[model samples]
Target chain A: MLNFLSTALVPLLASLIVLAGLRRRLDLFACFAEGARQGMGSILSLVPTLVALMVGVEMLSASGLLELLGRALAPAARLLGLPEALMPLVILRPISGNGSLSVLGDLIAKNGADSLVATAGAVILTSTETTLYTAGVYFGSVGARDTGPTIPAALLSDLIAVLVGGGLVKLMLFS
Target chain B: MLNKIWAGMILISTLAGLALGRGAELSGAVFTGCSRALSLAVTLLGVAAFWSGLMHIAEQSGLLAAFAGLLRPLIRLLFPGLGRGGGAEQAIAASMTANIFGLSGAATPLGLRAMAELAKGQPRGMASPHMQMLVLINSASLQIVPATVVALRQEAGSAAPFAIMPAVWLTSAATLVAGVLLLRLLTALARPRRQRASEKGGLRRC
Candidate 1:
């Protein structure tokens, strides 16, 4: 059920419905081609920015800095009612989506799938956005030089999401 | 902001990698990171192409306008300076709709289009409030389905991956609210004191 919803069903259904509804009046194939071409161009241009940010995140994680940082922030994690196991995940969550995913996978593997820590990690993974990546790619694509308020706003929101995600999991599942 | 963060990441990684005697690993990560990002862009290419193509059909069929109409009230509240019926509004609404359905890959191309639309006629390096808020909102996306999380849980052999629905819903909402509020507050605080500066003629008015 979950597989169907995520991978294929919803998107296919939505596309089919939209196509069916719009068939009579427009040249659908032409529109698709134009849009797809533009899409490709956008993604192509974003590759450099994405690569720069990803390398930053990847090296940060591989250099043991993440571990040191996580250890330092572990006490704050406890203060927020989050398990110590979640410290690295929360810290890495906003910086790198794929990095956090691997960490979440490791967490679930270590602590059973149904464990409170795993559940909270899963929720945090789902709820929080990758702040640095989004800022880099999206703003880079637009050629925006001054990211005046976006980064700080996104970081604060991520902080809130992490805390809220942990708190909710604790209240709902552990109680 | 982005330049600083990128430089900081490089600086920290280099210092830490050398100190920890993992210099080789750090160098390898640079190459691997490039490949990983390339593959990610390739994956997003497919997702973005399909959705953008579909959205083009919707736009040609006038469905895009109808969709933007539905979101106008909220869009207006968030971006009061944006003109109605403009490309930015259509792009933003399409992106938000795609995001709501939990397709970040698809949402991104639409967001890029929206940003481009918003960037038109603006100064080369300056980002308008609308652009700033849009970036923040997109960065802190609120998805209704969160299909990725469910799929991850299912793969991990959880009995019910969808069981985290409540947590997903609550947490996303909180982040969206917090992000928007912070954007509003910070932008207000960060604005230049143009009145005082203008009186002294210290800065030229654009």
Candidate 2:
């Protein structure tokens, strides 16, 4: 762990810090501030869906829909050779990464940090999150809501990422 | 209007969902389960509706215009070709906000609107620098909340899901840098030829 921190985390941190500094240029900062403000404003537009989405997930879990889904997905995970517990992670990941992470963390704890679940978590970490919703916020801010070209691309990218993460980790480490 | 319709449908569906959940002839425990799922969906849609409406009011009031003014200069400097349409500035702001709050679902509408704005200003046969920049930035966004990650970790019963805060901060920086660097490369390659042909024509006329 110490070696990983030294070799990976530190260097990554250094470069990222440098990039952050560069992004703070007057022009970039302006863009960032503007972007943030618009994002917030647009968020105001979808408050209901936002709230519903969150609560809906919670309700689903409470309703045992997730448990049902979990069981249904178990066979698929087994075929994929993924840890069944991580199915929650896969399902909720698209709706909300934060939600998914909580489940992933639990699985990791139960299955052990060194298990396939843990490694898969790392891979998923490096990929995109909440893509469709995000694409909407940015587009909506401009007052145009059509996601014709972008949605397909973003979803495709996300799907590829999931399989890639799960597959790579399985072949290299789990195998 | 569409939202209202969607809301009604969702509401009815959820209620029906409640019945379906509770209606198990065989499994008595099913009622307990369906009630919880429908209940959650109701709560989430309700809040999202409020926030989304707030944005509409802001839009009608022209707040986006005012906000766009401040970022215009900066946007122009970086995205000189936005030419009035890139609407990149607004889109960037909106996308950032979505990422920050983890409102990915709501973010898309605005992002598309903003991109259309950018496309509107672009000249024929030339891509809008602002639009491209938006794409790059969105691709490598530096998230503030990473709500999904947090939620996932928490759901999984992590002892310290928030521990990824440092990792997120670090990665955003790295990704931002990578994105900007890529944009810089693209810009260098597509810097509009510096008005050379027009300048040469003027010089000859002189």
Candidate 3:
């Protein structure tokens, strides 16, 4: 039942929007074209950042630094009852969305799709925003020099979310 | 900050490769990384574009505004100082609505406009409490449908792409509540200090 709902969600949403547009007498095709163009532009702008981050993350993993770092942080992760593999994702998540997504892909590849690590990673990714990027853009837009506890508060919240998400995934999915 | 992190990763990776005698492997990783990024982006493009287009239709048909209207009471509670039906209020509502619906392409612009509106008549270069709350809420965005993550999970061949939805919703709500409480606490703590500082300044002037 849940699987069917998930599969139906996108088509349902699309149909609903289209029907609404028709009812409003909108030029749906033209609107879609314009928005799709904007989406393409946004994706293009993301390419460079993705390339840079992916290279860095790949090199980190390929050179075995990630493993070393993971081992170094293993005690802390153990204390939190988290897998060592999730260290990179936890750190990269708040910094870069694409970077964290790359880490998440690697996590799912290393651990099976149904593994606790992958589920936890997915939950964390879905729940948390890219804190640094969001802060930069939101504050930068208004020329606000003093962010005044926004970043710290947000990061604290993200940490709570990540920890809670890992636990939730374990309890909900695995159990 | 991002610059530092990105450069540090490259430099550390190079040094590690040299130390580990994996220069050839490191070079290979560069190509693989770029290709991986491109592939991932290609996978994402279709979903992102389709969703963006669909959201555009929704926006044009006034569906988004209707959703925003539904969020007005919540907005009023979250952003207390905004005048009812004012620009900031409306922008905040729209942005929050877009965010919940996972239309980040629209959310960012609306969020920026809301920030600009909230910043009006505020102290120069200082973020008002309302502005801070706005950014905080955005950073802890409570997305009802995590479309991007679901799409990525699907691309990764997950048997159940939306299996994590319940967890996502739980975590998002928790984080948003925690963030709001923390922001309120910080703002409350800062207010007295600012007032005391101003009092000291007045004394110095006398």
Candidate 4:
């Protein structure tokens, strides 16, 4: 039932919006086209920042530093009752969404999708945003230079999410 | 701050790569990253364009305003300084709506719009507390469905992909609450220092 709702949500939303527009005698096609054009412009403006950020992230990963950082944080992970295998995902989660997704995929493949680690990873991934990416794009759009405690606060929140999410998975699934 | 972080990432990666004799891999990563970002952008373009168009219709039809009306009290609590029925408020509502529905691709465009709106009339290069608050909330995931994670779990052959929904809900709520509280605490802490510094400047001028 939940799966059905999840799958149907987007299409249902689209249908409702269209129906709403029709009822109001709105030129839905023209409105949509104009919005799409605006959307494309905003996205085009983001490309350079995205490229720079992604390159930095990719370089960090490629240089083996990310893996090393993960290993370095393994003890911290263990102290928090998290699996050592999840260290990399934890590190990458805030930096890069696709990187963390691939990491989650690897975790599930190795430990089985139903394993505690994979479940915990999935929960964490779903619970937190890619902080760096989101902040970069949002602030970049407006050319806002001073983020003013935003990143730190967001990262702290992500930490809370990870701890709470992973702890619950351990309590419920591990048991 | 972002500038520093970006430069630091590149510098550290290059230094580490050379030290570890992974220069070749680092160079390869540059091109790979660009291509990856481009492909990601292309995917974002399609999803964002479709959602933006739909949302535009929603806006034209007054559906978005109605949806945002339901969230007005919450918005008032979050952004007390914002006036009623402003562009910022509407964009924020749209962004939050997209976030709750787990339409992140749609959320980004709306969020960017909100940021742009919040930036207006403010001093150049400085983010207002409201803008920072918006970014903080955006960073704290608020999705109910988490469709992407569930779909990925299904692809990974989970017998019950959505079983983790409870955990997701708990964590997302906790994170958002924590983020809000922390931001408030930080703002309160900084206010005193700011005032003292300004007063000190006033004294020096005298």
State the lDDT of candidate 4 residue by residue for A3-80, as single tens digits: 466457667888998999999998888989998787677667777877887787778878888778878888899898
Greater-DockQ candidate between 1 and 3: 3
Candidate ordering by DockQ (highest first): 3, 4, 1, 2
In angstroms and one decimal each, the interface RMSD of every candidate reads 6.1, 11.2, 1.9, 5.5
Runs with alpha carbons beyond 4 Å of true place in candidate 4: A1-70, B1-65, B199-206
- The candidate scoring highest on lDDT is 3
What is candidate 3's lDDT per residue for A35-139, written digit by digit as tens?
A: 888777777788898899888889888888999999999998999888888988999888888889888877876787678888898898889999989999999
RMSD of 1: 6.0
Q: Model 2, which residues run further than 4 Å from truth?
A: A1-64, A75-81, A109-112, A171-175, B1-206
Candidate 3 residue-wise lDDT at A29: 93
Query: Tens-digit lDDT track for model 4 on B119-163?
Result: 889876768999999999999988866665665677668987778
Candidate 3 is graded, for docking, as medium
lDDT of 3 by residue, B37-105 (tens): 898788778877877788888888999889889999888888886799999998899889888988877
* CAPRI-style quality class for the chain A–B interface of candidate 2: incorrect
What DockQ does each listed candidate score? 0.44, 0.08, 0.67, 0.50
DockQ-based class of model 1: acceptable
| Better candidate number, 3 or 4, judged by lDDT | 3
